[model samples]
Target: MNAVIRTVRADEWEQVRELRLAALRDPVAHLAFLETVDAALACSDDFWRERAAGAAETGDGQVRQFVAEGPDGRWLGTVTALVERPSAEVRFGESAKVDQTHLVGVYVRPEARGGAVVEALFRAAVDWSWTVEGIRRVRLYVHEENARAAAFYRRFGFAPSGERVPVPGGVGAYEDEYELLPSASRDAVTG
Candidate 1:
């Protein structure tokens, strides 16, 4: 609960990669993330370095990554937000519906799950989103079966937009999209 929550540094790519791989190994990783542990582990060092650089504070408004680090200097969790431009097509769903921030790569170490680490990460991500000039809302998708994640999102004030993205290959799966509009009162919704 005493962890420091802040934006990631460009030089901390190895830390980013380490925390992400730990998240992938979580029991709920199947429901919470798209990438497998093997895939994450196989990524080149350059890939992680570039990713960290892109999400660093110095990267400007394009992308942002936030982290919660314990007093011991170990990273307990991380969340990344990507700024979706109006001129560009959205990555996962139907093309640009709005210029927004797509929240992704959310994770918390199991030992840190209930200690407010996730909430702190969300605060950082949402704060970053609000700083963007034209962002209308901050949105994220969760696997339909991820009740814990859904409950956390709801508790944090995200609402299902009633939009669903089918899992590719027709595996009879879907991910639900949730959003928190910038016009909404953040305190009223998330408290």
Candidate 2:
């Protein structure tokens, strides 16, 4: 699938909201996302506006959201990179031991899965993460039951980092940590 991968614009909050809602409704959303469709729907427009603005290209460099836009102008996929520092509040799992970026909110439209769109989005996100000063690695968490996501991440060179976080509200369930060191990412993408 031909797609244009770019950072989301602050003014495109509506499109962002629509895409997120769609992701939340996917069949595997229970394993892929932490938030529910009902919870996301309960959020106000201002909430979405702030989210979009914070991740937009014009916002602070701490966060960036990349979207794969189809030829028809539809958002086909998205992935966000968030710079994490030891001193900053942890958004998930554990506090950072070294400078790194966490990949989150990953999604691809049903029709766009198993295509180049997802790879393009990951390439864009990982490339953006390395641009941040002092970033040594990129990381993301996947539910243990979500084999499809885990497989893709493995193919992209993200290996288990030996850290696990308990899945919220799920008894005995966990999300395993996967990390990609800077050098490994380069080799993974190019080799």
Candidate 3:
């Protein structure tokens, strides 16, 4: 499908909220996302607006949200890149040991699955990560049962970092960290 991938704008909060709600309602959301549809739906419009503005293209470079817009102007997918410094508070997973970017809120419409749309979104997120000053690598967390997502991340050149963190509110569930780096370098770090 022909889709344009770009950073989200501050004024696109409504679209961002809608797309997030749709993602949370997906069948695999229980494993793919840390939040519930009901919880997301309960958030106020002001909360969404703040979230969108923080990730907007004109906002600080620490965070960015990329969207895949179809030719008809509909949003097909979205991915967020969050820059984590070594000293920053841990939001999800372990605290950053080095400067890096964490990919989150990845979602693609069901109709856009098995196509290049999701790939394009990932490419945009990872490509943007390298542009950030001091960013050493790009990483993301995938639930252990999320085989499809794990496979896709591996195909995209991310290797398991051997780090596991308990999934919040999920008893006995854990998410594994995956990092993108050159093969030679990946082995040294992930090994």
The model with the greatest TM-score is 2
Cα lDDT for residue 128, model 2? Answer: 92
Candidate 3, lDDT over the whole model? 0.89
* Candidate 2 wrongly placed segments (more than 4 Å): 189-191
lDDT of 2 by residue, 46-97 (tens): 9999999999989998999999999999999999999999999999999999
Runs with alpha carbons beyond 4 Å of true place in candidate 1: 188-191
Candidate 3 Cα outliers beyond 4 Å, as residue runs: 182-191
Could you tell me which residue pairs clash in candidate 1? none
Residue 6 alpha-carbon offset, candidate 3, angstroms: 0.6
Candidates, ranked, TM-score: 2, 1, 3
Superposed by TM-score, candidate 2 places the C-alpha of residue 20 at a distance from the truth, in angstroms, of: 0.5
- Give the Cα error of residue 137 in candidate 2, in Å: 0.6
Top lDDT model: 2
